[model samples]
Target: MSGGAQADTAGRHGFTPRARLGLTLIAGGAVANIYYNQPLLGLLVGEFGERAALWVPTASLVGYGLGILGLVPLGDTLSRRSLIIGQTLGLAVALLAAALSPNLACLALSSLVIGILASAAQQAVPFAAELAPDATRGSVVGQVMTGLLTGILLARTASGLVGAQYGWRAVFFAAAVVALGMTGIAAATLPKIPQTRPLRYRALMLSILHLVRSQPVLRRSSLSQGLLFASFNAFWATLALLVEAPPFNLTAAGAGMFGVIGVAGAFVAPLSGRFTDRRGPRPMVVAGALFVVAAFAVLWAGGAWSLIAVGLGVLLIDIGLNAALIANQTRVYALVPSARGRINTVLFTVMFVFGAFGAFAGSQAFLMAGWSGVCAVGILLAGAGFLVNVLEPRGA
Candidate 1:
């Protein structure tokens, strides 16, 4: 059934197939907004000049980080369906502004707003967790995240294609259209879920700290995922550069196409969720971390080998990164029922911060030691993530 048809019935139980699919689509689109500008950076630079390279990506990421910190916490204190639909409209406006931007500065500012509104995606994630039954929570998160990861990967491809055929601004224009369409779908289909916690915004924000101090599982899960995500970010930050240089000498379009290959990871997400449901989240987490370590090894070696090897490395890293993400999130959401929003805020805040740093670090590493250096850093991070899981406190 379509999301509109099942909205009323699934609104009560949260596990309806159509509802899950709807939430997944929303999550993906929301996340995609933040990434749509990446593949178009060269076009942005060509239009806006060299300064665009320095600030455009940074503005979006900083805005996204701020959005996660400031806006995502509201999930626990507001009507989620209303909040999500409203934010999608906000994102659409921002995308429109970006498309119409007259100068680099204008585009940068609009991109920042785009990032801020994109936190709406984070809301869908925790909502999916909260709505699912305990026995299949892992599976549900996995399915929802498959959409999120798929969006993250595909945003580049879509942007690259649209920007190449039209112009960079057309990417934003297309995104605006999609956001508006999604807003309508969400407004009609998503259940109107009331606040789980009625605390004032200040208190609710402060409570994230208290929850962090108290929950060892939350701490471990956050740390494990943070490290793994950092590794994942590092690989992506330098991937285009690596593929465009030396023997292969591909264009930005070629780099963006890699997103399609990475879809393999998204395909495995639901299967990982099922595995987490059957065995515990910990094993999948371990498996994910180990997959990262192996992926980095392949990447490091592939730096001197063939493009085929590097593509394999990309596929493996995405799979490992997303699998661990689903498992970590499944465990974290289960820690507190009413507090899922705050917990998610904390989790993603840490992950995003680390991911930002990873992008910067990867750039520096690639500049210094090329792809080999990038792979080394990823290996260490992924290995640390695995070790953290191994050393987790018995109860945690």
Candidate 2:
């Protein structure tokens, strides 16, 4: 299906196959930029050594956080299509830089730039929300998010396969080509929607802070999503260590296969969105939190058993994480129609910052207390998410 036709179907608020394909491609491209660094980390360490490799992913996370705070709000002030196209061009350049970097420091610095420009994905989500009709907004967002999650989960496997066959540099080169193609497609197919108001960059940033402080629904939803994502990040960040150990004794390629298992969550994302649209985000949010907690319990139980059990835990974690994410996004989008970009910026920025922290803490936990420590941390964070929901306004 052509991108424009699919977008038009979404614009009409009906489920069209073309619309699904278009949004999925857009979302996949956007999210892939953020995750392509994961499987490359080991390859990077082999070339650049441990210290620099450790810092490289952190640089990307930092860049992502900064992009959420600085670049995403521009979606409110500028045309989203233009913003996405511009960022896509920047991402292409950054990918090329990453591909050509001679040293660890250069790669790490380039990764930061890649991440900042990759905020295009963040812009894409709100754009999806804007394009979707009110009746199906949640479901549409869910469908788009499925693509995003698929990109994130599958990136590890894709990168590993490609890197193994053609070397690490090839991965970035492929990414650059994809970025360029996506940029052209987005520029041609995306509708030119006007912003609600013309606000100065300074004003837009200020408005984002105000929204965070003033909107009760936004505050609760953001916090809930933030904590949930923290747990999600923690689980994935530490998964390799667990799989590499005695019981599993898996190679990196085997570890990468777990990503394919996690793809189950993408299929579940649209269902979560439909539920959110019908029942409101509250029930989904609550249920999602419980599911995450259950995933941790399953991981704990699977310690001495089959690796299949661990794979099941990963699947549950992905499903719960994606469901909570869509539900929170649906609620936040409902709270501020005029400033979708700014609201999304705040939401994603907070969640990613927590994700970064979770990555760090998970590493520490793994080093200090093994899988049990990782499970403890994940469950505690999930519990905090439950508490956030409990404290939410009764009707909200």
Which numbered prediction scores highest in lDDT against the true structure?
1
Which ranges of candidate 1 are over 4 A from the true structure?
1-14
* Model 2 residue-pair collision total: 1
Clashes of 1: 0
Tens digits of per-residue lDDT, candidate 2, 207-319, equal 87799889988888888888988988888889888888887889877877888988997778899999999998889999999889999999988853579778888888888
Best by TM-score: 1
Estimate the overall C-alpha local distance difference test score of candidate 1: 0.85
Q: Which consecutive 10 residues in model 1 have the weakest lDDT in total?
A: 1-10
The lDDT for every candidate, in the order shown, is 0.85, 0.82
* Residue 209 displacement in candidate 1 (angstroms): 0.4
